[model samples]
Target: MSRIAVVTLVLHFYMAITVSTFANQTGRPNVLVIMVDDLGYGDLASFGAKDMRTPHIDRLMSEGMRFNEFYANCCVCSPTRAALLSGRYPEMVGIPGVVRTQPESNYGYLTPDSVMLPELFQKAGYHTTLIGKWHLGLAKPNRPNQRGFDEFLGFLGDMMDDYWTHLRLGNNYMRRNEEVIDPEGHATDLFTQWSIQSLEKREADGKPFFQYLAYNAPHFPIQPPEDWHERVKAREKNADPARVKNIAFVEHLDDGIGQVLSALDKLGLSENTIVVFTSDNGGKMKYGASNGALRSDKTHVYEGGIKVPTCVRWPGKIRAGQETSFTALTMDILPTLGDLCGVPLETEIEGRSFKPVLLEGKQAAFTEPVFHMWLQNGTKEAMREGDWKLVRDNPGDPFELYNLKNDPFEKVDLANEQPERLERMVRVLMVHMEKAQKIPWKRPEAQANVNH
Candidate 1:
């Protein structure tokens, strides 16, 4: 061929290559968000827990990055989940805590105004499905299906009955969209199966999908499959009976997670998918759950209450065999997924995207301060700003400040020694709370304190 003809061919090939690369980079990826109930930070082997063998979870960490200073936003289920779904503070959604009651009510529940991450995906032409616990709200206008998920099959309550068959009755039963019915097998296994079915359907539909597999395993009234119980019993080999049972239950949950993960691998969706594994909060330490030397347990503002295990895997996008100490919150998941899936969040989100750090394995910065409050009616008990955390028991008690950097366990009280620093942090917390529209705990004396 002549030189002019060869040059023309080379130019055409170069243009095609550029266009293909741009399409690949801008293409929306399928998202698989898996959240475990009451899973402690130190439960997984990748998180430095030598007790349990979490091969599936560890594989996710090995292929992605493990977040060491990640927090769950709330110490409980419903609130944290609300924050996770909306990318906003749970308190803003009026679900300051878990939603509990026989007949669900709209009082203090997540409202329709709050846009969920799944809804964003749905609008972006992605099929959204949730197969697991959705404790954010149970009343009308707050259900998962109403919030943007095309399909939802799970319990609306925080806890479930037995693993076999269906657990609770009359509003407690497993729900698909709005109908209540009994699902066979364990809740964990059922969730896994439903997730696989959704994946298969999405594959056939020729559309990207978002699957939220929230497992309510290893929570309370711990029970496990017979095989898992036998295996854990053999491993313990004469250890405490209760502890053995608890381990068995955890292992059983792990097995269920493994099934779903294996299905993803089998479906050949692993490379084009982004999977994030985390927990709602710390473990129930009373039941022999390890928090990896963190002081205190759930229900407190300490590290154990908020900080939890976190891992993310996005094949080809995120580097494998990476670990990061970059602080992250459960609320960040929505925005991060939004960035990865090309779904721009509509709600004004408090959490920022960590896409830069996840894809490049580089250190990132968080501009917004993370806040926490545990109140019964209208009370603020705990709040954290940056590395400084303040804990208060009642309105009368003095604020206890600690530098999480120096005292992550919150063992030492530095309020007296670092009065100025404490004051500054208190001001930061007060400003945040005010801007967030959080009502202070109702106390006659507290009103006076706030005015002063």
Candidate 2:
């Protein structure tokens, strides 16, 4: 062949490679974040739950990397949600605890100041939608639309009424943004249906989407469909009547998730879309949630309270049937999605990207120490840095330290023997607290009276 003809062929091959690389880089992947409320670490078969059936969620675990040390920033709902969305510590976000009541204007709520995951995605040419409980804030300036989401369909309070009644903020109504009205079906069913509809709409528009399916199921007011309750009760003969009802509630929730997953498959979105399943915090022990090897339940700093069930699935990209004991946090979700979707982070992100572990099965990338604190009303109630944990009632109280690595359940305390380690942990905790802008503890009026 002539030299010019061979050179032309080589140029075409190089151009093809360049175009293929550019297409791969520009392909915006869809993100589906499925967050369950108050599910414990041991609630799934893959996570070691023996009795209850979470086969669908377990399927996610079998098809994705499951993190054993995954944790919510708070043992409760509001703070954890704030931290997850903002990619910052809860204390930094000014949400000390759950926002149960409609508070004054000065009170903290999810506002425009927060840079939410959906907002980032929307800016990067992705449609953003939410279909489930949004307990962040109910007031005017704190709604999901005001914060980031372009399409919002969920309640705006910390908790809601029964699935049959669907009362939120004193009545049974589903909000299309800030407005509210009664929905035609159960909460779980409605959320799933809306999510599927949104997915379809986005697909038709030829734009990728970031969906936040935040279900309020299995949290409290544990009431399930009668038939589901019957099935659970029949299976666990010795279960408490009320606890059985709770199990049925979770089971029905699982069914709702099944519908969503089924929709993804039917629409052929599963292969391209990333699906993540996780809970806000630990489960209610009194309601019969098995926290596996951990002790205590929601509201405490114990493993059973903070550690939650977590699983992620992305076909063709993330390896299937994998489980790792590496530590992770809810804060990691934002950065992971950001990295995958090519959304350039506007500010510093607290969570590290677990993409390496998910795609390549690399374990060493998750060696960073995840810091944690639960301070309500400006008092450091609990703190965890790496393996050592410390809990205190007040400023005057001595720190109660535990080695979580040795005692995952936090049953033993070695504070007396490990003075050096305790001191080091305390110093590190103080530094983090200061950096995160944690408020100093102010004694309650009753405490002052007692002191006087």
Number of clashes recorded per candidate = 2, 0
Q: Evaluated with lDDT, which candidate comes out highest?
A: 1
For candidate 2, the TM-score is 0.87
**Best candidate, TM-score:** 1
Q: Write the per-residue lDDT of candidate 2 for residues 298-415, one digit (tens) a residue.
A: 8776678888888789887888887777677888888988877788889776778877788888756454445656655555456666677886634557888888888888878888
User: Where does candidate 1 have its weakest 10-residue lDDT segment?
Assistant: 438-447
Q: What shift in Å separates residue 88 of candidate 2 from its native position after superposition? A: 0.9
Model 1: CA > 4 A from native: 1-26, 102-107, 169-171, 377-380, 393-396, 434-452
lDDT of 2: 0.76
Local distance difference test values of all predictions, in order: 0.77, 0.76
Superposed by TM-score, candidate 1 places the C-alpha of residue 341 at a distance from the truth, in angstroms, of 1.9
- When summed lDDT is taken over every stretch of 10 residues in candidate 2, the lowest stretch is 438-447
Model 2 ranges off by over 4 Å: 1-26, 102-107, 169-173, 363-369, 378-380, 393-397, 435-452
